[model samples]
Target: MSEYHVPVLLGPSIDGLDIRPEGIYVDATFGGGGHAKEIAQRLDDKGHLFVFDQDEDAEANLWGATNVTLITSNFRHLTRWMKYYDVIGRVDGILADLGVSSHQFDDPSRGFSYRYDEPLDMRMNRQQLLSAADVINQYDAVQLQDIFRSTEK
Candidate 1:
């Protein structure tokens, strides 16, 4: 477990994966690499794990694992990238921990925790143009309500 962000349900989640030592897998949300590290350990040289995270901060937690490939991009584009890597149809398992990590919540600079006063920037990817401040300031009442109501893309 990383001090940066501890993984939730570590044992059961890996058991649920039913990972094959030689199988290919995907870690869709590699926050602090807690899950990714576990997945990588379960794989052999023949096996591979493609890990994805939109936040550049995730790169800091990457351990030197030979069987893992870290892709610094959103998992929403999984198909396109998987096709590019020629593992589109061969993936055996995928693990996605969608909850915000401890690191993100604890970092006052990220503006996620209310314990400390900071800028209202809650962007997962700092490179993105739109931000929490922009949305709150620019969006109208109806627009904000619509966003709050719908979870679908």
Candidate 2:
């Protein structure tokens, strides 16, 4: 796990899954795998958990889980990714904890926080080309304002 990201709503999220000993579950945002770890503990040898995280660092957190299949991709592509993994609609439960992890915001190099003085680069998938910097530096002022307004809830 990166020093900045912390799992949130972990207890309620895992409990809500109501995991079956032999069921299949998917954690679409497997940041640090904290919730996945808890789910794995509840599963029997026959149970399976599919985890996905676009960030390469997140894959390092898959230790100690025996029956989990990890995928390196964004959760937005989950349905397709699951199909690619051959575990599509058969999933008993799907957990999607949306938003960037605390680690991403805290890590100065990740450039997720405006409060920090670093290059603007807030990409969950480091492989992606459209970074915060790219958007800000390339987009005109009007476009930047539109992006800010649209992204705001």
Candidate 3:
């Protein structure tokens, strides 16, 4: 019944973390907290889970998770924030689920999928200025082609 994105390869993904009961962990992309919940459940009172998510919608799902400390920022600055929180070197494991969530692709307004003819805004972080529309409209054909080609690898 939960509308949240169900994390792919849930068991194997978390297993790869090699979770320790009293260790500190980081869920770099806490979309729907699917993996975070599993990580939290395995941890005892001495353990901690730091969740980083740029999406504000994810904040609602984190409520009541006593062991979790939600950081509302992009994971690209993960090391910076970890240092700010003073958990830098103490971290036991870090898990990052990259790529757009199913929730983003399913929502027509988010403008990710070709299935829906919506605006060309494809920013996962809604606060960002550069959108898909901006790239297409602002960039020259050569620049755009070069950008696309780089991602092929």
Error of 3 at 3 (Å): 1.8
lDDT of 2 at 138: 87
Worst 10 residues of 3 by lDDT: 1-10
lDDT of 2 at 91: 89
Give the distance in Å from residue 64's predicted Cα in candidate 3 to where it truly belongs.
1.3
Order by TM-score, highest first: 1, 3, 2
Off by over 4 Å in 2: 1-4, 141-153
The model with the greater TM-score, 1 or 2, is 1
Instruction: Tell me the deviation in Å of residue 147 in model 3.
Output: 2.9
lDDT of 2 by residue, 1-153 (tens): 335356777788888888898989988888877788888888899889998889998877878567998989877788897788787778899888788988788888999898888998989898897998888778998998897899896
Q: Each model's C-alpha lDDT?
A: 0.90, 0.84, 0.89
Compared with the true structure, what per-residue lDDT tens digits does model 3 show for residues 10-72? 899899999999999999999888889999999999999999989877887885978899998
Question: What is the lDDT, from 0 to 100, of the residue 71 in candidate 2?
Answer: 85
Q: List, in order, the clash count of every candidate structure.
A: 0, 3, 0
Model 3 RMSD in Å is: 1.7
Which portions of model 3 show Cα errors greater than 4 Å?
149-153
lDDT of 1 by residue, 1-153 (tens): 487888889989989999999999999999999888888999989999999999899999887888988899989999999999998899999999997778888888987777888878888888898878889999999999899789665
Question: By lDDT, is 1 or 3 better?
Answer: 1
Of the candidates numbered 1 and 3, which has the greater TM-score value?
1
